[model samples]
Target: MRFTLFISAILLLGCTPKDTIAIERQLILSADFSHYDNFFPIQTLNLIKKGIKDKIHIMYVCFDPGIDGEKEFPGEDYMDDFSFKIMKDGKYQPTFDKSALVIGNDFKEYFKEDFDSYKKLKAEGNISRFIEMPEKPEWWQYDQTPKNSKGKPMTFICQIDMGRIIINDDCRLFVFYDQDDRMVKYVYQRT
Candidate 1:
């Protein structure tokens, strides 16, 4: 009887579930632009006209915030801190245009407020607004292509629009999204 009781107790303990904790994963950013062949060719010329003379650096960086993996984070709004560079001759040249880069959350939010006007401007192909980029990424507008830890495309949360060139007058304008497509990374120099 004692042996049976001990065996039963061991079985009960073994049957109990073990406590486990969900491991959080770090976000990953990948630079890939092979998907936008059409926009680059034409936009490259426009960039040159704006004084960018070298091959435009196209980077696709996707951040995967592991906890809520299903959310889609747009890279255009995720640029908190970044470095801009230009390729001069045969080398990568760091740019001093850092001061020129501005974060425009208010402008974006304001623009978003007028959905009808925004749509109209977008339809007219004049949606580019020269404003500061958002200081922090807007998680609420998490609309982008989802990627796995390995940097592989998993699923798309929302349809990406074409890249838009927000002209900074004669100085420079960074292309956030073209048509309906978002770029992971973009770098150029102001001439």
Candidate 2:
């Protein structure tokens, strides 16, 4: 299983867009899953990036790793929900035809100011990105990953939490990816 997973990872990396590979290579993830939490950790973000970007489609994952009644073990990497919606006519509207509500951006304009891009991170005069590994120790690869939009390849980029009051608690991660920037800007919500 590990070998299959590793080969899949290699192929996935080989398939990613060149530009998405050059994004925020360095980031600090702080999850509320811990106690006495004061955002103070410099762990690398590439592990999560490589795992999801390579294996899964360049899209968003509304994931919460510690949701109750699901995982048999705490801190186990589990993604059972990928719900997504849009704000149309000043009210939340569903844009999905299925359970996986994938929201994708064009090849360019990933860092644009509009909410169409998850870079809507700059609120309250600040920008924040969060990612944290479960006590599971590693995120090798995802099973049953999603497919890209418009039958085009995409690259996973960054993550955003719409409900950011506290991370890894009740917040569903907003993972984004793209097919522009030479590839797609993909984000997988791994909270």
Candidate 3:
């Protein structure tokens, strides 16, 4: 009886190969970054996805366009360009830190919580406004754009919208449904 109802629910919700991803999400921020930086200042990463249903948080990051394969950061004195580096093992903490959040945690503790947006908020010693969460991923918006022959989501060549922190003006963060991993993975793309 339960099995029958579950199937019915999926059908009703228009579940397709692309719509429903079967991933058992956890309560922690278990992300896999391609780069490594001990003191990468993760608190400044852009919180791209604010899970309305699963309560998941996805961090957006970038890498050197010159490098190939999974993104990796160089030594401390690299003069960061794209902001795609990771923490030096000791820098990244899996546990949640209230002060690290850019938005969604409500304004509290002043500059700590809004570390990335602090400068933006202050306008010549006057407080403008805070930079809130950018918005959910643009899956639905892209849905309207025709898919390719293989039925994959149409990949726009260049990044159009600029995210608050981690994502730059020409960068875009995409949600890659990793079926084998049984979890959703966020993809930081230049195009």
Q: Tell me, by lDDT, which candidate is best.
A: 2
lDDT of 1 by residue, 143-166 (tens): 333333356543211111223332
Question: Where is model 3 poorest over a 10-residue stretch in terms of lDDT?
Answer: 38-47
Off by over 4 Å in 2: 1-94, 97-123, 129-144, 149-153, 160-164, 167-174, 178-191
Candidate 3: C-alpha RMSD to true structure equals: 14.7
List per-candidate RMSD values in Å.
23.1, 15.6, 14.7
Q: Compared with the true structure, what per-residue lDDT tens digits does model 2 show for residues 26-138?
A: 12111211121111121122334444322222222332223342332223223433322222211112122222212234412321222322333423323332332122213
Best by TM-score: 3
- Candidate with more favorable, higher lDDT: 1 or 2: 2
User: What's model 2's overall lDDT?
Assistant: 0.29
Find the 10 residues in a row with the least total lDDT in model 2. Answer: 25-34
| TM values, all candidates | 0.20, 0.25, 0.29
List model 3 lDDT by residue over 35-131, tens digit each.
2221112112121221222312233332322333222322211112122211232222222222222222232232233334423433233221111
TM-score winner, 1 or 2: 2
